[model samples]
Target: MPKPPRTRAAALTATALLLSALLAGCGDDGSGDEDLTAQELSWKDCPAPSQAQGGGGSPSPLPDDGTWQCATMKAPRDWDDPKGDTIGIELIRVKSSGDESRRIGSLIFNFGGPGGSGVTTLPAFGDGYEKLRTRYDLVSFDPRGVGRSEPVLCANDQRLDAYFQQDSTPDDGAERTELVDSTKEFNAACEKNSEEMLPHVSTTDAARDMDLMRQVLGDDKLHYFGISYGTELGGVYAHLFPGNVGRAVFDAVVDPTQNAEQGALGQARGFQRALDNFAADCTSKVEDCPIGDTAQDVKDRIAKLLKDLDSKPIEGIFPRQLTQSAATNGIAQALYSKEFWPYLTQGLEEAYDGTGRTLMLLSDSMNGRSENGEYSNIAAANISINCADDKPRYTPEYVERKLPEFRSASNVFGDFLAWSMLSCTDWAVAGAADHPDVGAAGSAPILVVGNTGDPATPYEGARRMVQALGKGVGVELTYRGQGHGAYDSKNKCVQDAVNGYLLDGKVPTAGTVCS
Candidate 1:
């Protein structure tokens, strides 16, 4: 048992503090969507069990029935409204089993979209999560106005298709205006059609709903897990219910205090770092690599392809041709996983021949566009919640100024990647009052996971978050992996570490590192 390197251990400890905090909203981003400061309604007992018809105020028992139930619980239309209007919550409850029978409580999982769906997760990606299912009920649902729960739909299919298919990067004034107009149009339509629900979709409000769910499920406290955007949602819950927090794990954490504008800029810088990693990894394989001898070469090749797509979108992909939108999306997608950079090389290779199916597939995944011409509207939700979640430091001209640096950093994906900031420029709601500092609260030890090379969420953000939260003394779990969420892995080490904590309330020792 040799001592860990002093400087290395110091850095590790600092990293831990930052990330544990990042996953929570310590800073003020007043977007009611993320107001961690607001005090929460106290946790109460669950409603009478599904089996209990009526009782003399006896708390209900858990539904032992094997089948998981998809049901709606009710919350307030507005947190401000103590009793005015009620909103129904859609939930999926997977019951626990066997020795794990006497489970602590329901484990609420949110899959990160301010627009993401929880219903579709387990059957698809929870392959690594079945064990947790055996101990506690694994449940998730479309958060208010998201997915199957009376979702927010803006346009009819065709126009919606156009919306998803629209170019993210605007080259000329007309293009930028179109992007702006399109965004405005979507916002207007969403407001006009989904007006009643827009304000209610804020994260704090949803955290409140989660407490209600905890009550209905009879959990005295919460045992929760959130990913990506889910981390924000989880932080909101923790902030609103610091007393009720228990064994919470925030994987692929999001920095709460940084408003949407900051988030986008950080994400842009992040993707560039991820791309650089991918390029280096790709070229190391030489023949298998798609980019050239250097990471810069790959970036240059990508830029040339995007510029070409902007002028002449390559046809032959699917319902729509390979537009700059597709190319931008494709490049961004590859930034998430080093595994995909090979495809990045192939995409570049094909586009260099004046075609781009390889790249379009990458774009399709990045945008969450399905084969049926359907999309998750994640990009839309990304804009909606992000813009609403926080106020941007509006220096409109700063966008133009940052162009060179962003491009040099990201090449093909810079503007489309960079312009994600623009969504906040015209935000309807300002951010939280102050991005509160997390980890200041002396609650249970929080677990912060960071992939050394995640593109969208980025490792630096995680480092900053853990550092902020840990203040140099917290549990920092390193996942030497790539992509947005690493827990999706079937890998034994990650599984063991996470499962041990959730099931046994164990927190890995400080400076614990995993590959």
Candidate 2:
């Protein structure tokens, strides 16, 4: 669901967006060697982007802009439309002030979330990317069904709001009925209203769009940086266009072959890993960690609190009533970054002693809840793109059978997180059966990053992606930290390695673990 720049639900609507981690791993007391496994994951195909500028849906070129310009590139809403009756893709190009003289054409970035919007992303990251900006023009554009572009709309604001607020997790049998029914409703609505766009918003389609963006930019190659789901997009691009591969950095990559089910399972494991880390941090600073000496004790207390909240809503900030599921997510979200550790420890200590406000604030921000009660649009996009792209892993029977496993998977979030999956079940289209295993793409050299304890896009994902990209180099930056997408943090070593690749063609050697 990644938009080139603007977030769909992944980061856009807020709920679906993967929150950015602000710090790195410094301490680990929990049990679960949460760091990425260093085993060399043997990869398969790594294709280069095809630069054969001849047949098959010729891209409509847009005029080059020193600053900002919008041009149309030809694509297919159906892909069977090669006769010039093409889908008009809108492009926005912004130049860096540092690289006018030695500027290469462009370096595109996908922030993930199948629904992520690049158009909406430029304003935030455009400036910080000064290093790469000077080397190449920073290009951002909305993917087909995202911001500024032909957005794929399902239920409008009010309906979506209702759907999101519904309790995703249901403890009792009756509650499960409500969840199933609600999910069915959302799915039906999407099917009825979003018939036109669902089939088109896929990783494959998005990759092709990037190729067109490259062609229109007049560059012979495709240089890209993507996070989370964005990594999925970049990986697919490399598969589809191995010949035109340029400098690439796939930060926090997603293995294209794994479907949402397996991906969700990995995420389930990640949260457990993070929770174990949190417990360790809490226990070490007795004063900071109020939950006894044992990690299991801490988990029990939090679970108990969530259970209490489920029966009776708390009277706190906006929305007035915080759900137990949301509360648990706040904890998981907090674990994504090391900067939040102090506050997270504080929230835990207080919660163990009967206070949950601090943690509530963390959850509120993660879901994009404004001081006023408005949820971000990212939730919508996240549901749409993911649901559409991957087929459902659980059926009524499968979900019922797996309930205990998922419950053990997230504790306070097990139920709600389980329910958050209904969107794909009801989405208008059933996209790829699974992310295409493109190991045979024969793509160019790529750099894959994995943080040891990244709860969001787990380190395993990076390891798997590296194995998936047979020819790419894997740079394992040992964070001894807790967070996702480590490049954004102030880690000089990792930053230097990343910049060297983007600005200069310096790819780190295999097993190049950074501190």
Candidate 3:
């Protein structure tokens, strides 16, 4: 199965390097000549999954499971002209199962991956939050160029598989040539197949779509819950439609203040912190401790292992060997959620046993690759959205110059995170929006959640997000724990406070902590 739908968006920061490129698009002010209409969502029974006949994987009738009703609402392909071509906004809804009189309203969700399917993510939340279901209708949609929507398909499975295994940390001129060639090849595939859609699949466009969804759902104001990259979407929506914002929750907040480079570097440091947390926890235990007694010792062992993989890839069940990129991806993916720590330990143990099959599977799952070689549009769409949102150019010279700083930020994962920005460096089209200040100054009280040990979004971003949202309008809720997000984690205090705010508009005081 794919990694939990709460998968993170790529970390592309606005760097000083981008100072030279002129930012093209501006935020949508929701003021236009054409009027928007609320089309009724024609709901229907969701389709069941088509079972696999052979070893091939089962085809999912996603955005819909039998428990919910599904609809495809029409949205403008280009929001600039409301009269322009239309695209389907795939949606799914689960009505309140509680007292009808107590219904709060429809709660819209965006579960982070600029590519993550709300259709897939909402079910996970729905299964856990019974109270949320009773009080409000839960709704989620596949954003433009994502999932069931007009997805951005760049390379096919074979090409992407090769791209994933290519060495990211180039030690020599030949290695750098391979890395650059693979990146350019992937970009060419995207340009070939999705050039038209690639230019428009940005956070600004997605935020406008959210307003249209609000109108169709008959909600006077948006009741939103955005996690991880979803927080960026939520912040964007608030910026564009502050008047329509109501009871919005941004968990695992992205730092709007940071540019693409800062964002990337922040994430690198965040992952390193999470790795340290994992090390600290593992070493404290008598069993399943793959590293040493001290955190630095654990780091040393991991560094040695990654170095070994660089020269000699361990054989795995997958078509490709366990390359360093895949190994790092697997380790980073496991760090997103604490529940996967044991699997990380297991994978590392098996790697020490000379086979990297387990870690390869973890990496594959995180990348949305099925066992039968069927790949989802998550990776493709993620690249397109991020590139469209923040297209910062990077050269071999720039990467080389900044490599030391990146390594300083994160001795283990820094190089990979910094190089992650390379795919967009030569984007076919410029980024749609510069991601202007999203303070959303006049929006209704917005609750921002942050985890102290979050490996992806980082706590500092959440703190900064609150500051950007302005005083009184934004409230900060801190989860003093290790994870990418705070809500739905083990902390009941954070859960109760968020649930109360979403359901009853009760904002927790600033600096609220859930230990």
Candidate 4:
């Protein structure tokens, strides 16, 4: 799965609404796009989110009764042929609250996933960014091939439920064949449903779109905030339009140097490290840890539970059962943030007693499945964007060979993530590159924040991003803390540095450390 944004409240609320119910961009610049750049967006009252964007009511008023606005900007569907066809890029924003004279330009955000709906997410967590909104219009969008932005579609929800329920960690040849076949079927569905889009959803295309967005928004420079996969998107934007970058910050940074295989391996290690942290935190609490006696014991018990679920699934939300795959996904989702640790503990405790609602809900959140059985297009977009960006495609045999290495990196997530490498097998469009190029030599200083306990992107990625971005272009900040990103962690130190840089043009010192 792609690294989801750290929207803990939204994820949890989705589950509650579902048990009662259910739950659940690019770039830059310039030449041959004069009409697009000059087009004025028809911003209006926001409508309720579409199913592709994850079904939800329209955004509520801001804390000060400021309404969120929505707009769709037209962009060439194919950057190679700028005038050939057009697609809508869904956008949402709230104007700056402070005096207009004091306001900076728009502060656009990309909350990662490479597949996430920034249109929906911005409002879900708009309050967290209230301070930044004081001086800049907080803007985000559903990049092309995502949400209402000419979304990519795959299998129906019913098929997806079965698809996700399949035994991901095969024990034999037959099971391996089944896994491969299922992946091919999923990819085929994507091609059948979105053939035109498959070829144009590359990160490079999105980067160009962002540049167009910059022009349409009337910003001379792109002031930005990116998290997780968004960081990678931001890096690509900077690389493509170095001179257009203004104040930018990349949190939970993705390593721009690693190829697909290396990236997966890094995540395996990152997630395992987070699991260790979760276990340690659980055991060291003053209250008795209900799940285990020691840190290792906690992990051991989880392994046993998964082992048992492989053969005999547990009761999940009525009619569905929690299989090993679902349990593993749930655990990984919880490991995304320290605030979610308690939910993991509770889910584990409940699973031990044969109930799997909590874990299943977590897995549902991960997969973009809602209580009503409808799904957001996140999974489809994630696969499409990843397959389009990552050049390498893995076969079962290659995955089998790499299993031991993956297992060594993470016994719990090893086989699972290893198998995930086959997501692009038989994909329709050939990928763009081995990995992303984020070398922005002339770009403004971009703050790179890495959390020590981030499971998805990993802490090491921050330094790797800094190095890959070229010296003096990427300034590194270490948050010796937990979660997928730092600023949202409500860490005063991390936020202070980011706020200083973005709001006042005061860049934090290179190699700054915040606890």
Top model number, lDDT: 4
Total colliding residue pairs, candidate 1: 33
Residue 194 lDDT, candidate 4, scale 0-100: 89
Residue 392 CA error for candidate 2 (Å)?
3.9
Q: Let me know the TM-score candidate 2 reaches against the reference structure.
A: 0.80
Q: After superposition on all CA atoms, what RMSD does each candidate show versus the true structure?
A: 10.9, 12.1, 7.6, 2.9
lDDT of 4 by residue, 74-138 (tens): 89988888866688899999999988999999999988887788898888889999999889999
TM-score of each: 0.81, 0.80, 0.90, 0.96
Q: Which residue runs of candidate 2 sit more than 4 Å off their true CA positions?
A: 1-75, 84-92, 99-101, 285-287, 290-297, 342-365, 372-375, 408-416, 419-421, 471-480
Winning candidate number (TM-score)? 4
Model 3 residue runs over 4 Å out of place are 1-36, 48-66, 433-436
Output the lDDT of residue 395, model 4.
85
lDDT of each: 0.59, 0.59, 0.75, 0.87
Question: Model 2, clash count?
Answer: 55
Summarize candidate 3's per-residue lDDT along 1-515 as a digit string, tens digits.
Answer: 11122344221110111111212011122333454564677787644311110012222332323267778777777877777667777787888877779988899988787687666556545665566777888898888888667778888778878877889888889998888878888888889997768877889999999998988888899999898889999998998999999898998888888767777788889889999998889988877466566877888888888999999999865468998888888888778878678777777888877888767877766676656666767787778888788756677778788889989988888888777767676779787544546778789999999999898888998888888887777898889988778876748999899998988778898888899
Q: Of 2 and 4, which scores higher on TM-score? A: 4
Q: How many backbone clashes does candidate 4 have?
A: 18
Q: Estimate the overall C-alpha local distance difference test score of candidate 1.
A: 0.59
State which candidate, 1 or 3, has the greater lDDT. 3
